[model samples]
Target: MSLLDLSWRNMKRNIRLYTIYFISMLVGVIIYFTFAGLMFNEDVVTAIQNKENYKTIIFVASMIVFLFIVFFILYANSFFMKQRKKEFGMYILYGMKERQVASMVFYETLFLSAISVTSGIFIGGLLSKFFGKILMNLMHYKDDISFAFPLEAVVSTILLFALLIGIITFQSYWNVRRMQIVELFHAKEKMDKPLQFSMPLAILSVLLIASSYYTITMGGTSNLWKDYFKESLLATTVALIVGTYLFFRQFSGWILQRMSRSKNYLLGNKMLWISSLRFSIRGNTVNFTFNSLISAVIIFGVGFIAVDYAVKADVVRKEYPNDMIFSSQDNRTQQQIEQILNDSHPILAHETITGIQTEKIANRKPFLDHPDYYTEEFTIFPEAQLNAIVDLRGVGEKVDVKGDEAIVLTRGIDQPKTYLSTLPTMTVFGDHTFQVVERIRFPLLSIPTDASGGSEHQPSVLVISDEAFEQLKGTRPITSYEVYKIEDPKTSNNVSRQIYDIVKRTEGSYYSAFIDMYSIDIESSSLILFSVAFFAAIALFALASVIYFKQLREATEEREHYAILRKMGVHDNVMKQIIWKQLLFVFLPPLLLGLLHSWFLLYYTVILIIKDLPALTTIIFSVMGLYVLTYMIFYVSSTSIYFKIINEKNTR
Candidate 1:
């Protein structure tokens, strides 16, 4: 058989052991393909036709994620290469030249990588349409988008993977070239105990971990992400990674010694469990470090991902009841404008009158917390604009302050003259003394995320009752809200004409109409693009962690332990239970903590977007489910490898 056929046969012969590596690499390719396609999808391009920044974010995020996947595929392929050392040695012993062996390895990898990557990308594209629809639906976008299997995206992702595979293949070739017959012939020799790390390293690790986590939770909210940001994270991560590995390196002895002395908590299977864990920790310090890093990466990556989604999905729309909204200035009378608007669209809701509130917000340092809160200069609403707004949104319902008393509600403000002033300022008009009430929630289109991703703000009408409307006389004339609700939403195309008519009839100026679909498209796309990038980083860390541990387990000693345990009459069921327990120790804590972290991040991000918390908590469950489904697939594949080791032990 040709080298291709021989290598293919060898790969199939050990398919069980190689499947995890293959599947992970394939999934990475798929994710990259899907994201690349989505980023440049025709619909997205058409919708954001002239928006350069949006495309830039899409490309930058895609490139970062794609490069990450490349490194991951290469890193992951290393372990598979290590595992095949014995087969390579035998190929050499059977008089196969190293050059031919290199050719064989390259062909097999190229064939396997191509198959997996192509299949993965194909599946990813097939499903991306559904994903796009669901996302658009969530934002209540009525626009129909076309999602073609983006050939360019597929080609780009494939070329990247192919290049990565070539690098890994070359690395294998170098390994074969360097291997002497002795090392290859004795590939199954036992491993020796590794030198322990110094005591200071453990303490350092503890300090590093505590410090890094503190920085993440505290610093992640910063908007100055362009500056000292990346450096700080890099320094912290390096400290954390080195320290953790060192701590785990010597951790086994310390743990075992303590547990052996404990009279209560150390007594039964607990000690054994601790012993096993400590053994794993000591023997697999690198693995433990890998796991911990993965967990932290998951927390950080998902935190950012969820937060980005929440910002666009829930926070940004908090104050805008529609695509565009502004309260009018109080001095102007908007009665004629409201009437004109009412006369035009029979189905449009009337202009809502809201009680304007005024407050002299003190200090104001914390109000606009983020540096990007607002621009330096913007116009405050004039009295005429306020009156026009009142005409549009005024609750003509009068408050009977009491007999012979009238109170006027006014838009109140004491806005500071800085770029940071976020809350609006209002001026009370007329002779009415309007007392300040607590700052109320602003209006925004509150489309809940339904199965189809509906994006529409709710209509709420709240104003002072008739008893509260009268206290003192005001100069501003009462402008009754005039709105018409039509049964069909689609027929509201003429609402702009109605507004213009109102403007002409009332001689009204500064009227605005809320537009749809475009805004929703922008917001949702920005969020999903961020989400895919953040999640890709997390997935990389998780895959690295799982595979690292598996590599550690495959090192000669751990497999021998399985052999010894079987020979000692341990029940197969007990052995299975132990493996199960081991898997949980590795998997559960991070998963739980990562999920809790996701909820917290989601909560904060949502506040940034919509200025309200999600009423339903099921999203937490959904996020958790998604994580488990994806991460656990790799975990399960790794554990099944243990069973194969146990079988090898028994046969011996």
Candidate 2:
């Protein structure tokens, strides 16, 4: 057959295998683009928006996804090469030039890349709308940004994979180039010699394990440890990864080599264990390597999201205990609020607070930027309305006033404009009556009920007294409600809902605190689930599928070689042992190393991620167990197919 004909035939014959590759690529696109959409969604973006040098997080995350795609696709290409090695080797023996064969392989890769990319992009377009909906739900997106084709993001994604395919094509060519005709034809005859452990390797492994433990545990979180030990911690992680590989290489082989020595203990499936372990290491060199890589990724990935969820989950409930939060323009509902709270729940901690928004003046006179802090916005606010809204957090607490004059608290700056890095400037207008009081800080978290142009993002108001607020706000009404922490927030919500029913039937503009809390919870949960599902799918599918596919090809190749030994008088049991044995050794080192690598990764991720330590551990362990179970099942299924193929070829 002509070279073009050979390439075309291979594509058709290997269509099933290529389908795996194509599907994986397409799935990866869906996953990554979904992640991008989530990050850029308006609700989630509010958290990330222009927050002090935070644009880099999106860029870094995107780059990681792009690089991962490139590497993963190329890794999958190894299967195409493995399946075709015999063909390439035989063609060379039959007088087909190496260059000609290389050209053919390159053409096949190019054709495959083009086809896969086209299919992926087409599928991506269809998935985007559904994907967008999922993202909106996750972010609890109250606001929306219009979605278009996103030519820039999509085009960049395409070019990235194209470059990756180009690299894969060249790598395939390189493999073909390095092979001699004899080795190609006799490729199945190549054997992996048993490995022996060196003292240096064993010592290094011990040292690496020790260092990794110390670095990861880090004792506790502190600026002192973080500043001085960060680099060292990173270095130790690298060491642990390297050490895991080394340990696996020697330890796995050493165990198998010593297996036959313990005949008494070697009874039962000891043979299977030994055999499988060896074969795993040998035939699955790359598989083992990648499994380790994935193990590490999951350790960090799941740990981060789970921990963040647990921590934030608690804080949000305490901050907003009710369903609907609203404030009016006046402060006259103190008695009504108490009545409602008593009516809603018997256990109510009723209190009234007053607050005022700060004002500034260019001269002795003052002008208030946002004076609505004295107005009654929410029905649950304090009696005088200026108790806690004015003069809070950064600008207010640090200032001092003498007699009629006041200087607002402000940070000393390297430059005038840059002083407000995380703070706002104290403004003044000409000839405005301004009296600065003693600056003081407000509470950590509170939303502005003062909607008369008062912003929630800026510094807040603090009320010194009820009378002061009443004088400032001019008969504004205060928010009225019962504030109490129940034994169960979940149950508290239900009770509040019941009370809300009562309020709604009897009055206008009546809202339940329970509804507000429930809505926020729903929003947060949706976003968390959205992020976890999309990212986890990408990580799992890419890492697991690649290892599984590679292992399948390797098993097939090993089955061919094992059959030759069977004909040379090795017993059937021995033949099976050998086949399983090779896989065990090949798989052991990489898989074990990968697990260790993941362990350290989980530790570091826990440090950076804000959360409960227990949750992080749980997620890491769960993901690791999952990878192991999936791999085991895949191995069993592939092994059966592997032996079946060999049996058919031998009969032929």
Candidate 3:
């Protein structure tokens, strides 16, 4: 028979074994094809505001997906090749040339790739409309998306996967050509030496990881990070990578060794799996460490996206309480804005806030420690007017100012400690020294000015008693904000645009419209969330498949040991218990450590910026629960397949 016929028969015989590999490839193809289709979809391109940016983001995301698929396919191919080494060896022993065997392997891979790509593209085309609708909904686009199988996307996907298949076929051909017959026959029997614990390395691993965490969390305040930020960041990343590797390579083995020596080591089938794990630790260490790090990345990425999407509206509203805000010294300009808003939408509330701006404050000593905390200009508001504005917005709590006391609001500062107690007293106009009663992190108004617009400078805000404010009103440059809350602010884009044009043309005047800023934020965040969700899905799938494949390979190697235990009168329940323990050992460590790492990362980074900690915590836990559920599904599948392999009658 020709090599092609033999290769076809081999594939048919081993179809069951190829099921996971084929599914993984199919999923990769579907993701790539779907993303490509969206990139070329006319509806999506036209509906989104920034067409170039949208296309660029999708293109970059698709490239990343393609790279990941390449890695996954290559890894899967290597596993299959390793599993079939003995078969290749037998083919050589039966007088078949090595070239023939290699050709056969190539043909098998080619056939599998063709089938996977064809089926995957067909499914991807069918799912494109559903995914498009999801993207549109996330982006808050009202237009209906019509499905079209873009010829460009189809041709591009075909060409890319075809190149991938060619590369895979060449790799299989090369791997078969280079393998010695003896090496192939002995490949299944080859195992790493038993793990040896090293005290020095274990200690180093702990120190490395601990120091890296400290650097990431606390280093921002340190001079090293402040002065050499890039270097510090790079060092932290390197330390984390090396530390994680050492953690699995040495620290984990040390712990296992200690556990094996414990008094209860031989209890309840512990000896069965514990002994096996100790021997296999050397082989599994790298995989465990890699999966752990990837898990952390996946969690951190998804957690940030979830929190960002959840809190976007709240953040926008907090920053801009008034649906439309503009400052104008010209009464005619103000009248024009009022006319524009009144004609376009129903007005919910309208209020005016008068404030004074100062270039300097007499009590600058409090800000000496962090000069950036002090702005060149300060916007001072009277307690009554500020309280009225807050009450009108119906979002924030109303503040009360007592005699000679002021409440300070720092623009864009999220951390409470950064603003609270840092400013105890303020002397405005170089004469009136007021006691600082409380400090708020966000600004009261959203308009950009010398007090709020400069880079790296926070706008200083003070709300004093009404009597105190009247005393200094004539001494400083006065500014007034015409704030308006209109009906359906989020949907009033056209009205916002009209007002924006008028405000931009007026001298020394600016405006903040809720729809303008909120739409950009919501759309960008929605796109990020959509992309990240899929990336996380792909990572989880890959991680699970890697573990599944490794477990299956190990099961094949340990089948004889299991068969011997069965003959020695081990019960079915007892054998299953052993398998469960072994698989749990493989799956649990990475998950727990990854969770811990991600939790710390988010706490130090993402959590600080978020206003709603309780909501963010809920989102994080939900993500964790979902991640755990996915792993559990894979764990159960691996265990069942492993049990079947071990209990098979013909394991030769």
Q: Which candidate should be chosen as best, given TM-score against the real structure?
A: 3
Error of 3 at 5 (Å): 2.0
Ranking by lDDT: 3, 1, 2
lDDT of 1 by residue, 224-264 (tens): 43466888768766766665665556543454446555887
Stretches > 4 Å off in candidate 1? 43-54, 143-147, 186-253, 260-283, 300-308, 311-346, 351-530, 533-545, 548-557, 588-636, 648-652
Q: Estimate each model's TM-score.
A: 0.66, 0.62, 0.80
Worst 10 residues of 2 by lDDT: 409-418
Cα deviation of 22 in candidate 3 (Å)? 1.0
lDDT of 3 by residue, 28-105 (tens): 789999999888989888777667778888899899989998998898988888889999999989999877887887
Error of 3 at 638 (Å): 0.8
lDDT value for model 1: 0.53
User: What is the per-residue lDDT of model 2 for residues 395-496, given as tens digits with 9 covering 90 to 100?
Assistant: 222222222332222111111121223233233222223344433322222342221111343223322233333444554444343233333343334345
Q: Considering lDDT, which of the candidate structures 2 and 3 is the better prediction for this target?
A: 3
lDDT for model 2, please. 0.52
How far does residue 258 in candidate 1 sit from its true spot (Å)?
A: 2.5
